[model samples]
Target chain A: MSAAERSLRGRAAIVGVAESSLGEVGPGISSLDLIGQATVRALADAGLSKSDVDGLFTHSAFFAQPVLTTAEYLGIRPRFADGTATGGSSFVGHLWHAAAAIEAGLCEVALIVYGSTQRSHGGGLVASGAALTRSWETPYAPRIPASAYALAAARHMREFGTTREQLAEVAVAARQWAKLNPAAFVQDDMTVDDVLSSRMVSSPLTVRDCCLVTDGGGAVIVTSAERARNLPRPPAYILGAGEATWHMNISQMPDLTTTAAQESGRRAYEIAGFGPQDIDVVELYDAFTINPILFLEDLGFCAKGEGGAFVSDGAIAPGGSLPVNTNGGGLSYCHPGMYGILLVIEAVRQLRGEAGDRQVARHSLALAHGNGGTLSSQVTAILGDESTL
Target chain B: MTDNVRADVESLSPETAPGTVFDRYAAEGVLAYQSCGDCRQAVFPPRVLCPSCGSDDLGWEPSAGRGTVYSATVIAPRGKEPYTVALIDLDEGFRMMSIVTAGDDGAVAIDDPVTVSFRLAGDEPPLPVFAVEADR
Candidate 1:
């Protein structure tokens, strides 16, 4: 990429971020409605109008054509409409694509949005249905998503000497952060023991270890750095971004403990001209407790097989050295099916010093990592304030 | 199953989707996997092309039904019976998802040796499962 020379580094910045009605939205609200709500709010936050959006990026678990549906519902036709999706973290990948589009003069003022009603629908994981690809494992009826994540956690413990207590530490840290967030849905005080005794949905992963099933939608407004700086609010520049996926399903993953985050984070850091040491706040997709642990290692925050130690002793807690998932994260915050875009919202808020009580002291450099599928798709984005620009 | 050996069987492509072929063989008490002709790489849920080398040339071979549990988890679905699910690292190098009959919930652990067996419990075709067994 460096050889190619032309880079998207600091070429684009996130001007605005907003979330729609979070938690359960009940029967009247649909996924598209949430997108409309969030998009309108984000545009206002950017001090821009709906017509300013010439580019659109969105992905949905239930929609056949996300971009088309969102564009039609929002009544804003865009020259660049992308529905290219892998999974939840699809929006984080959109940041990189939007930056490239801006640099190529393809489109300006790109909108990345996502919404889900999985919680109001069933309030639990959508059960795995019978399929050809899943034929190998569906017979046993492993309560997918959770069971797949448990497989990785179990393998990590076996290979790295990671204990259940360590995995619990990840959940505890997220809850502690959630307590400080007024908008966070779950604010109840939680401990490592509470996570351990929360009824094992899967052998190692208790029900509490899984992310919250809620209905929510989020939107991020991205434009060239020149346009972003003039906005009403301070800009959270897209310093660098990268996306990677190694497998489509958990069974096909080459290694259970490690994820594609290693490659994604490396590329992101390389393009950003920095590493984890320079980051102040970290917002990672925590669909499961083990996720942050695996991502911390793969994302270069700590050594491989040392994620357990890195997250232990309240290392990622609010007052800890490295603040991660400050907005509660998917573990305690609203999951809303794909919680990737929501992560960027938190990072941008931290960069803009709008996180309120949950704000970390250093608001300059931030890292937001999103994981999709069963820890399959990983997208890393390094964001910073005007100081870094 | 034993009762529907000659019953209606739908046609399916082994490369695009290998469920039918694997089920047919599982019904007859055999566990088969594909080996890439070019890379000699073991392929599971049989694919047409070699995932390792992109060569469409592949061959089918029966597994010894022997493997080690790469990872295992006991899924307790509320009131339902708990069972150990695992990813089995076959001797041939391919890994697959299956169940281990550990007799009790949470009995199976990672690195346990297991062998595949067939079970026909639902209206669908027979599927391969595993039971703890000693193997080198």
Candidate 2:
């Protein structure tokens, strides 16, 4: 079923997008401080005040009662609050929830926020005590997040003959994009050999194949499309949004080679009345190198098992047919634990024609997809210029 | 059940969680999984309700302890002994993730036939593992 009949379609628009100073923010700074800084900057960018926000949406793997904490810290009692913690894609999911809230007259403006001090606090990717899977799966081997993705990568290579070079191309392309983004954590030039030769975290996944860990935070303001016209920047109209969760643990995944993006993307496209060929820019979560490849295939950008060849020869580079992750990605951009929020922020910037160096020729329609857990949860947000609304 | 194979298995204690029945069976050197009483369908990592039929009437049943390797990865950290982790599709119908001991060579591949084994670490009960079938 599609959201064609739902009023939420084309009803909400992103009015503001901003990020805290990327890269190292030092040890004294906490995630709460980052959230406050980004929230103020984003609200200012939207030409809205903290009092204008009646809805709040945020998630934290490290902090408990995050939505309440943000509300109390920001000192704005929100009528609507959502702390839907589904890993990195929580922010993308929040967009859909906020849109529904606005359409139902529950709230006028919503603030979606995320922050992490993983680098400054020496926090690892998987929160130290967060038990993701069953106890049975943990004793035999360490259950680090990369090892989980490594299992899927191994299965995909065995089933489809995907080579290491193809996976390395993802890292290389991300670096090329990062070179243009001043806020990117690592903009150094890299080659396929550099990725292939990096220290192996898991079989078939090198350190380069993994995303960088840094302290960063980002926020976006969403409100009714009618109110967005009076805002400071061009509003990125929300054409369609979809989210799904097939499994929580990698072991329980029905198919290792495919992710839930198939269902989420299909729903989003059906609602938007558009297809893969129509997307002008794409920002997909790249927590691992294998993620974008799987998302490309599962989202119907390419045929099944053909993602290896689809991404070769700079297909996703800045001047390519489909520009993906224009502000770099989790692979090169800042990955403050959950990288989903950053994806939507970049999509909004691209759709608004604000992406300075890595802007695509046609910036009307953009698709931002986020993968949470071990490719277990998938969320797709289709943003477009106000003209499309 | 193989009672004489105590030393060959890991001696870790069963986790005191909702699904310790699976661990109880593992500690006894018998591989068992939960089966719904209504649908007779197998469920792994034991849950209170059957995912397919939504029946809470579940019972434990012994498995043949054999399956194929759905996927495998060698996690070789620096200065550490490398071990192979795999997702084994059990013969009874459920899939599980566990470490694989492919003899001294530690050689394993996808779709290889495997048999269930057990290993102990610290004070925890024996955890189920997989080993490639010798003839395969």
Output per-candidate TM-scores for chain A, rounded to 2 decimals: 0.97, 0.97
Q: Which portions of model 1 show Cα errors greater than 4 Å?
A: A2-6, A126-134, B1-18, B103-106, B134-136
Q: For residue A363, what is the lDDT in candidate 1?
A: 88
Q: Candidate 2 chain A, which ten residues in sequence have the lowest lDDT sum?
A: A125-134
How well does each candidate superpose onto the true structure, as a TM-score?
0.94, 0.95
DockQ of each: 0.75, 0.63
The per-model lDDT (C-alpha) reads 0.86, 0.86
Model number 2 iRMSD: 1.2
Candidate 1 structure quality by residue, lDDT tens digits, A277-380: 99999999999999999999999889999999999999999899899999999988889888889999999999988889998998899999988888889999
Candidate 2's residue-wise lDDT over A192-296, tens digit each?
Answer: 999999998888899999999888999999999999988889989898878999987788899999899999999888888788999999999999989999999
Scored against the native two-chain complex, candidate 2 gets a DockQ of: 0.63
Best by DockQ: 1
- Residue pairs in steric clash, candidate 2? B10-B119, B10-B120, B12-B123, B12-B124, B12-B125, B13-B124, B13-B125
Give the TM-score of candidate 1 (chain A).
0.97
